[model samples]
Target chain A: AQTVTQSQPEMSVQEAETVTLSCTYDTSESDYYLFWYKQPPSRQMILVIRQEAYKQQNATENRFSVNFQKAAKSFSLKISDSQLGDAAMYFCAYRSPLRDDKIIFGKGTRLHILP
Target chain B: GAGVSQSPSNKVTEKGKDVELRCDPISGHTALYWYRQRLGQGLEFLIYFQGNSAPDKSGLPSDRFSAERTGESVSTLTIQRTQQEDSAVYLCASSSSQGSANSPLHFGNGTRLTVT
Candidate 1:
């Protein structure tokens, strides 16, 4: 079984500043996919960024990026130049490389942005 | 993308009653999934369907919870004898394909279910 853990229950960042959300997972599978999802007040789950275990290079999507350390089993999300709209519940999820494998998610971290 | 859509945005039912939640996957999507999110928490995987094949129900908390998919299009999660603990937001998501390492899931607004 794979388990994802987000040590921080809540986080806050000043507008235009950067914030990093930590995430760690325990998985025996060598091949897998990692993802970060954001759920706003509207409650719609939106994809933030994703990382492939096999890729040594980190994944970056504009202001959003991931620091994936496969050996350490760590995948953390970094939000650069944070804005008020970035305030939401962020979750780290894992999906097995195997076909039909279900996605497992960690307890989310509530983000707050200060103006 | 059309994105995944769910019906009955909100549902309230009494204990011991059976409730069904619907999920409509995006056109041409081959994978659908059901998840449960308790208030102020992360998502809990409930079930996964690949086309018309057998679904993976490993995440269902109990036998009272079951789901079905029709021709890889619409899927429904049925919970029998609903309990107070069952009250949560039921989310639906779909992906272009399953068993792939790179596919990212697209989620719907979710159905808020309350069991009284």
Candidate 2:
């Protein structure tokens, strides 16, 4: 069984500043994928970024990027130049690289961007 | 539909009653999944169907909850004799990853199920 943990329940960032949401997971498999999803007030789950365990080079999607440390079993999301619209509930998810692919999501972190 | 669309955007049902939630996955998508999100909680995996085969049904909380997909298209999640604990948003997702397992899931807005 794979378990994803997001230690921070809530975090706040000033406008134009950066925020990093931390996530860790426990999995015995050697190959897997990590992801960050955002859910806004509308309650639509949107994919933020993704990182494959085999890729040491972190994944970056404009303002959203991930710091994936496979050895440490940690995958963190960094949002740069945060804006008010960036405020949402962020979730870290884990997916197996095998045939039966299932995604496991963490408890989630509520991010608040202050103007 | 253009994206994964779930019907009955909001369902208010009494405890012990049965409810059926529907999901229409995107065209050409071979994978469909059901997830539950309780208030103030993360998404919980319920069931998964890939190209007419459901290889994983382990995430379902209890036997009362079951789901089915036909011909790799529409899916329905049925909860029999629903309980208060079953109140939550039922989310449906679709992906193109059939057996190879690399595509990411695209989620719908979700059906909010309120069991009182």
Q: Which is the leading candidate under DockQ?
A: 1
Q: Compute the DockQ of candidate 1.
A: 0.82
Error of 2 at A53 (Å): 1.2
The worst-scoring run of ten residues by lDDT in candidate 1 chain A lies at A95-104
DockQ of each: 0.82, 0.67
Return model 1's CA RMSD, one decimal: 1.5
B21-80 in candidate 2: lDDT tens per residue?
Answer: 999999999888898999989988888887888887888999998888898899999999
Q: Which residue pairs of candidate 1 clash? A: A99-B99
- lDDT, model 2, position B16: 95
Prediction 2 TM-score vs. true:
0.95
Instruction: Give each candidate's interface RMSD in Å.
Output: 1.1, 1.5
What tens digits encode model 2's per-residue C-alpha lDDT throughout A1-115? 8999999999999999999999999999998888899999788899898888888999999999888888899999999999999999999998887754478899999999989
Q: How does candidate 1 score on lDDT?
A: 0.91
Best by TM-score: 2
Name model 1 segments beyond 4 Å from true.
none
Question: Which tens-of-lDDT digit does each residue in B42-109 have in candidate 1?
Answer: 88888888886554667899999988998879989999999999999999988887446578898999
Candidate 2 residue runs with Cα over 4 Å from true position: none
